[model samples]
Structure formats: structure tokens, C-alpha cells
Target chain A: MTNAIEVTGLRKAYGSVQAVKGIDFYVERGKLFAFLGPNGAGKSTTIDILCTFLRPDAGTVRIGAYRLGEEDRQIRGMIGAVFQDGLLDPLLTVEENLRLRGGFYDLRGRALTQAVEDIMKQVGVSDLRRRPYGKLSGGQRRRCDIARALVHAPEILFLDEPTTGLDPQTRKSVWQTLHGIQREKGMTVFLTTHYMEEAAAADYVLVMDHGEIAAKGTPSQLKDAYARDKLILVCHDTARTAARLREKGLACTETADTLELPLASTLDALPIIQDLREEIRDFEVIRGTMDDAFLAIAGEAIRE
Target chain B: MMGFALRNLKVFFRDKAAVFFSLLSTFIIIGLYALFLGDVWTSNYEGVPGIRYLMDSWIIAGLLTATSVTATMGAFGIMVEDRGKKVVKDFVVSPLQRRSMVGGYVLSAVTVGVVMSVVTVVLGEVYIVINGGDWLGASELCQVLGLILLSTLTNSAMVFFVVTFFSSTNAFATASTIIGTVIGFLTGIYLPIGSLPETVQWVVKLFPPSHAAALFRQVMMAEPMAEAFATAPAQTADAFREMMGVQLVFGSTEMPAWGSLLVLLATALLFYGLSVVVLSRKAR
Candidate 1:
């Protein structure tokens, strides 16, 4: 199957600072690809180049078979973008805003009207069609923006932090809408999000840092790669167990009431488990998460 | 492109402040002209000396051109606001051709300019008639109206070119006003370009407004087009015809209306074409 997006040796600079450092990646058709990064990780710059909002200083970007520089007009037709800032006309009603966007794609007459109505329905904003965009709730405006992006039936949608400032319920609604689009139309989605939960929803994730790809894999694969297989032991006699573990030269993290050990193997856990039975009241072992993978790679906490 | 243009027009009309300011500026200039020159307009053309007749026409022409500059702010602001809001981006990525966008914007500017000019001119004429003056004849009125249209078109092209390069509304507004005011004062919109130094006259001659005002002054003061062309130099009938051709090229209405129209068209096309190229390059 053809890739939805392919970037080779992409680089960009702003004056003296390099924003993107020769990064390369391809998004598979119909799959949701999430670009997970910290605040200054170059996600936005990359998205801008792909969306045709900013020119790359070097390299090639191809959306389907269309090259970025050679067939930009054709590439633009197949891609939809939800910019970081909502680009709606505050003076226009929600329906009017959608109608104007449809006009950009040359949709007119009855077809334009139907297209607006259909997208509004899909995004669940049909009732707010007559209200001015400025008066709508933040979530409603976001929904309207999404509906506008989809009005032209673009095959690849680029969403830049789509749920950045939304409340939990609103963010969930946005995620649900995105999921619906992906499932129903099989539209390839490329999104950038700082939210780990949102990143977890992607079929593939690219973790970026310092203008380079730090890691790339499915969410589960990342979790598996970084799994420490650790066990947490909560006990009344933590001092004795901690001393015993320290004497054994095992790596252990101790709290006021518990001692945690990084168990390298199941056998190592069994021996420790057998020795600490009387003092241990509770014990639990769990697999690592994408958050752990991120922390491990970047050596910095993800700014939630 | 039509959709964007029509939408821009709709927004401009919906903006009460923009409409009010455009109309207010036009009327204020016309009112000032009437208060200062009512008697001169009513005086018999036969008794007035030739030079004074020429000067009176020059002043009126400058005022008309100044009015065009004042009224175009609203249209220029609309374009600037659209760019800030990324509305231009939506169009840039679309299949719409660049020429259509330019045509649509120019058309909208012309429509607004024409409407404002008519209202201003009609009110100015009524003020003159009410103050014990006779109404202008049909041919004279046509000539004045043609001057107004041509001057406004030239002003629009100049403003459009400026706004295309300078995206900031404040910058465009400040620069256009400063430039327009300087041109108006130097060309003697309230005085007479002929009364200025030879160096000043040479400078004004290079600008479209100088010729535009000359044409307007000729019609307002009821001077013959031939008499206005005679202000420059003595020459062969063919050389005189070529000078008339230059006036026709820069003049609006009279014998050489098409020339001014072409100048305005060329300026509008060049600036608009540059705007398109800049916008396309900026779009990644």
C-alpha cells in the first residue's frame, strides 16, 4: 500500500536556530500517526511544512504521489489542516464560516449547502449553525473548525494539538469525532499532541526530542521495550528488608512503608518474595507505560 | 475568487464603522470645497482671468483626488484584516486563480469608490445650486463624473499596491495617508500646481494625481480640454496632439480617457500580480 505521507531528510531553520534536523518518517495510509513531543520538540514546525503553511529549508515531502514543491496545489487538495489557532471568522455564523470554506474548494449552490449541513451533523454542530462563531463555547468552536477542515473531503488530515486546551469531556468528544472519521472514511490522521492519553490512542507514535526522532513504534511496542518488570512491596518492616536487599547488592527504592526492587527476572522476584513474606502485607507487579518510555528516552518528565 | 470577493464586499457593507467613515470622509471634503469655492464655482467663466480659471480647476481636481485617498482606507483595512485572520491562506490553497482574486478586490474597491464619489459630488452640486448657482449642464456633469471615477480608480491602484507589500493595516494606513497628504498639498489641491516652483511642478508631473487633478479642474471650472493641455508648452499640431495624448494618457475623461484607465489598470495588475507571487511563495 502507498504511504499517505513521506518525508526524507527534512530540515528547517529560523535565523540561527535549527527547528528540524534532517528528520525522516512516513505515515501509512488510513492509520492514525501521533507525533509526541515536548514543548520545543519541532512538532509544530514539521506540521507547518507538511500542511503547506511554511516552506522547509531542505528536503522533500510527498503526500501520496504528489511532491511538495512540484504539485503543491494538488497536494493541498488531498490534505486538511486544523492549525494550532482556530482560523474561523468571528463575524460570520458557524454555517457561514463553513460555507466560505466550502467556497475555497469551489463548492457552491445546493452542493455547498448540503456539504455544510452534512459536516455540521457529523461534528454535531448543526444546532449552532446560525450562531456567530465567537459566541460559541471553546469546544463548539473547535468542533466547527474540525468540520470546516473536513468539508472538502481531504484524504489526509493534519491536526495540530487539536485538544490542547479543551476540558476532559470536550477532549474526549474531539477524540471520538476523530475516531469516527478515521473509522468511517479511513482518512489518514497525522496529529501532534502533548497529552500522553491522546498519544496512546494512535496506531503509531513518533517520539521526538531536540529536532530528532527519539523513538518510533506502536504504543504497546514502546511500553514493552521500556518495561522494567518491577515489583512494589509495602510492609511494616521496610528497614530490615531494605538492608537485606542492599546487602544482596540488588537495586531497591525504599519509601517510608515499602521497598521497591527492579526485578530482572521472575526467578529473582520469587527469591525476594519468599524472603520477605512475613513483613510484606501487600505486593504488586505491573508493566511499564508510554510515560515510562518517554521518561527513559528524554530523561525529562512529560509536561502534562 | 468571486466567492472571496463577494464575501469581502459583504463584510465591508456589514461593517458600520467602515461605511460611516467612507461616506463621512467623502462628504466632509466636498463640504469643505463648497464652503471655500462656492462663489468661484458660481462666478461667470467669461469674466475670470485665464490663469485664475486654471488655478480654480487645479484646486478642485486636487480635492477630488484627495477624496479618493480618504475613501479607500476601509477597503484596504478589509484586506489587511483578512490576511491577519488567515482568510487569504484558505484562498491560496484553493484551486482559484490569482487573477480572479485581484479582479474581485479591484471590482469591490471600484464599486465602493463609485458609490461614495457619486453621493459626494451630488451633494456638492446641490450645495452650489442652493447657494444661488445654476445646475451644471449634462456634458459638464458627465465630464466631472468621469474624472471622479478615473481619480478613484487611480487611488485604488496606488493603495492596493501599497497594501499588498505592507500587510500591516496600521502601516498601510499611516503610509498611504502621509503619502496622499503630501502629494495633495504639493500639487495644490487647495492652491494651484502652476503657482508652485518649476521643480515642484516637475515632481508633481510624474505622479498620476497631477494629471488626474488637472482633468478634474478643467471640468469643474468649465475650461476647454485644449486650454488645459496648453498649460505645458507650445508645439506643432501633432506635437500638441501628442501632449494632448499625454494628457489623455494621464487625463480621465475629455479626449484621452482610455490612457488614464490603462495606467490604473497596469498599476493594479502589477501590484496584484506581485501580491499573488508573494502569497504563493509563502504558502509552503
Candidate 2:
């Protein structure tokens, strides 16, 4: 299958300040792709250029077979975007906002109404359809924004910081809904996020810094290549657990809450968990994370 | 384009404060004319036949002309709000063409201007009749309606041009205030054009909506004007009409109705063309 998005030598600058330095990347079709970076790392500039909102100084961008400069209108019909800011009209109801967005794609009358209904249901905002957008909670508003973008059923959906400012529960719920929609529709989900855990869900990740690609790989590949693993034991008394583990000739670091034991290999995980099962309230083999991998590769945290 | 235009209209009407504020200038002008300006203008024409009707029609004509400008400015407020709120980016990235987006805004402003102007005309006629003035005949009413359309086109295009320079609601609101206050002076609503200095009278003549106001006054005040000046000399009535700007005079030549119509049409075309260029450039 053709890639959902393709770019070569993509470059954009605001006057003397270069927002997106020359870069190259492609997102595979029907995959969850995350562009990970901190603020001012050109994540938005790259997305804006890809979504046809900003004109690049130099590049060839092809979104689902439509060239960026020449076939923008066609490309627009094939892609949807949920920006960092709320695009829904606060004065309008959820249904009205969806209907308005649908109209932009030329859906009208019964067809437009049905699309709004289906999308509202899909995003679990069906009950909020009659409520004014301003009256919705933060989580509800983000869901409505996603629903608005989905009204046209674009082949690829770009979400820029989709879960920013959301509570942990709401963020998890939003991700679950996104995954369901992506799986059901086989839509290419391209997103940029500040949270490394969010990027962990991507089939592929591109870590960017200073307008350049710092690293690109699957989450596991990134972790394996750059990060280290450890064993975490949570208990009521971490000092007691650490002493007991130390007596068994297994060394561990004791923090106020947990004992962190280094793991040389996965083969050692089960033996340790079985040995410490009685003393520890919780025992788990901790794999290296995308956050660890990102720090390892960039030599700095994703967020300052 | 119609979809976007309808969305703009919906957004405008949904915000009751914005709707009231858009017509706020028109209401103020009407209030002043009824309470204070009416008495002063009537006193000037004391002992003259049909003074009440003539002065009432004069003020109503100016109000109708002012309606197009103020309402259109209010309509453009939606565009500014969309941009300020960043909702415009959604449309920018949509399948909608840039021209269609601009067309939506321009069309909605014209629609709002025309609609509000019609309401003003209805209310104005009612007020005039209550004050011993006459209702416009059907033919004259049709002529007045046609003038409103042209005036709205000119107003919408011109306001859209100014609005393109702003991307913040605060800035747009400030512009609306400035335009609302200045429109009366430019259209000779606050005082008769002849009463201003000669240079200012020329400025009024050159103002775009002033021609539309002159056109509306010609149709609205025609009967009352004839009755008020029936015993006066032909030159006296013509001079009074020109002085008050019910008729525009260029040096020695008194401009015919078509001359004012041509000026309005030219204003509409010029500003519309300019705004399209500005919007196209901004779209990129």
C-alpha cells in the first residue's frame, strides 16, 4: 500500500528564523505514527506544512497520492486535522459544529446530518450534541473536536497534541477511542505529542529535535537500542524488601517507596519475581520506556 | 460558499450581544434624531409647509444609509472572531477553496447589511408616518430597496477590506467603533452637508455611502420636499436639496439620479475587487 504521507527535503522558515529545517520522513498507511518532540522543535511547523496550512520554503509533499502544491484541495479532502487549539465554535452546539464542518466538505442535508450523528456516536459525544460547545468539559470538548475532524472520513487524521491538558483518565479514554476508530476504519493516524507515553502507542515513532529527526524506530526497537531495563518492587517497607533481596546476593537500590533492582536480562525477571513474591506487595519487570529511549538518544528530556 | 455564509450568519445571530451591538450605532442615531435633532431641524423650517414630514424623511434616509455600513461592519466581526479564535484554520485546511471562504464572509456581510437595512427602513417608515410624514409608494420603495442593495455591497466590500488587516477581536471591535462614529459625519447625518465648510462638503460628496444616502433621500423625501417648497422658487428648492445633500452637485452641474447610482456601483466594484486581491494574498 502507498504511504499515507510522503515528504522530501521539507523546509520552512519564518524570516531569518528557520522553524522546520530540511527534513525527510514518510508515514505508513493504516498505522499509528507519532511525531515526538518538545516545544519549538518544529513538530507543528512540519504538521502545518503536511496539512497544507503553511507553505513550505522547499519540499515535495505528497499526501495520499495528491501533491501538496498542486493538488491541495484533493489532499484536503483526504486528510483531517485536530489542532492544539479548539476549532469548534463555542457559541454553537456540538451538532451545529459538526454540521458546519461537514458542510465545508460539501456534505449537505440528510447526508450531512447522518454523518454528524454517526461521528457523534463514534466519539461518545452523542449526548452532548445539543449542548453548546463552551458548556462542555475539557475532555468533552477535545472529543468533539476529534469528532468534527472525523465528519468527512478522511483517510488520514492528524492530531496535534490530542491529549494535552487532559486528566490521566480522560487521556486514556481518548486514546482508546482513537485506537478503536483507527482500527475500525484503517485510517492513518498521525499525531504529535509532548508525552512520551502517548508516543509509546505508535506503531512507529519519529523523535525530532532542533528541526531534525533525532531518531526513528518502533517503540521497542528504540528502547532496546538506547535504554536500559530494571526490576521494580513495590512494598509497604522498601528498606526491608531491599535488605531481604540483598541477603539473597541480589543488590537493589531503595528509594522511599520502592526497591529498584537492575536487570541484566529478561531471563532473570521470573526468578526474581518468584523469589520476592511474598515480601513485595507488587513485583513487576520494568521494561525501558520511550521516555528513557528518547532521553538516551537526545541526551535531554523531551520537555525542558 | 453558501454553507460557510450560512454558518457566519448563524454565528452572528446566535450572539445576541453582537447583534445588538451591530445595530447599536443605528439606534443611537435614531434616538438623537427623534429627541433632539428632530426639533432643531423642524425649527429651521418653521412656518414652511410639510416641515415635519420633510425633516422626518431626511433623518430616516440618513439612518437607512447608515444601517448598511454599521450592520456590514458587524457582519465582518464574525470573520475577525473566527480568526482570533483560530477557527479559521479549520476552514483553511478544509476542502473549501480560499475564494469560497472569502466569498462566504463577503456574501454574509452583504446579507446581514441588507437584512438589517430593510428592518431599519420598515421601522423608519412607521416612525415617519406617526410624525405626519407619508409612506413611500411601491415604486419608490422598490427604488429605495435597490439602493440599499448597492449600498450594502459597497459597505460590505469596504468593511471586508479593513477587516482583512485585523486578526484580533479587540482590534476589530475598535475598528467597528471608529467606523460607526465616523460614518454619520461622512454621510452628512449629524449636520447638513451645506453647513460644513466647502472642503468638508466635497469630502461628503466623495464618500461612498454618501451617494447611497443621497439616493435614498431623493426617493424618500421627494413628496414632502415638493410640498414644503411648493411656494418657493424652483432654484430655491433645488438649492436646498443640494445643500442638504438630498441631491449632490458638482460645481455648476447638479448630478442626476443615475450619476449617484453610477458612483455607488463604481464604489462597490472597486472595493470588492480590492478586497478579493487582499484576501487572495492573505489566503496564501
Clashing pairs in 1: B57-B217
CA displacement after TM-score superposition, residue A63 of candidate 1 (Å): 1.4
Highest TM-score among the candidates is held by which one?
Answer: 2
RMSD of each: 6.1, 3.2
Candidate 1 deviant stretches above 4 angstroms: A227-241, A248-250, A254-287, A301-304, B18-64, B85-87, B122-148, B176-187, B190-202, B220-284
Candidate 2 docking classification:
medium
- Pick out the ten consecutive residues of candidate 2 chain A with the lowest summed lDDT: A295-304
lDDT of every model, 2 decimals: 0.72, 0.89
- Candidate 1 per-residue lDDT, tens place, A1-304, comes to 9999999999999998988999999999999999987888888889878877678999999999899978877888888888777877776789988998788777889999999998999999999999988789989989998998999889999898998889999999888988997899999999998787787878999988888998999988877776466788998688887887789888788877877887654456777788878878998875566777777767675553
Interface RMSD of each: 2.5, 0.9
After TM-score superposition, what is the CA distance of residue B113 in candidate 2 from its true location, in Å?
0.3
Locate the minimum summed-lDDT window of 10 residues in model 1 chain A: A262-271
Candidate 1 TM-score to native: 0.79
Which candidate leads in DockQ? Answer: 2
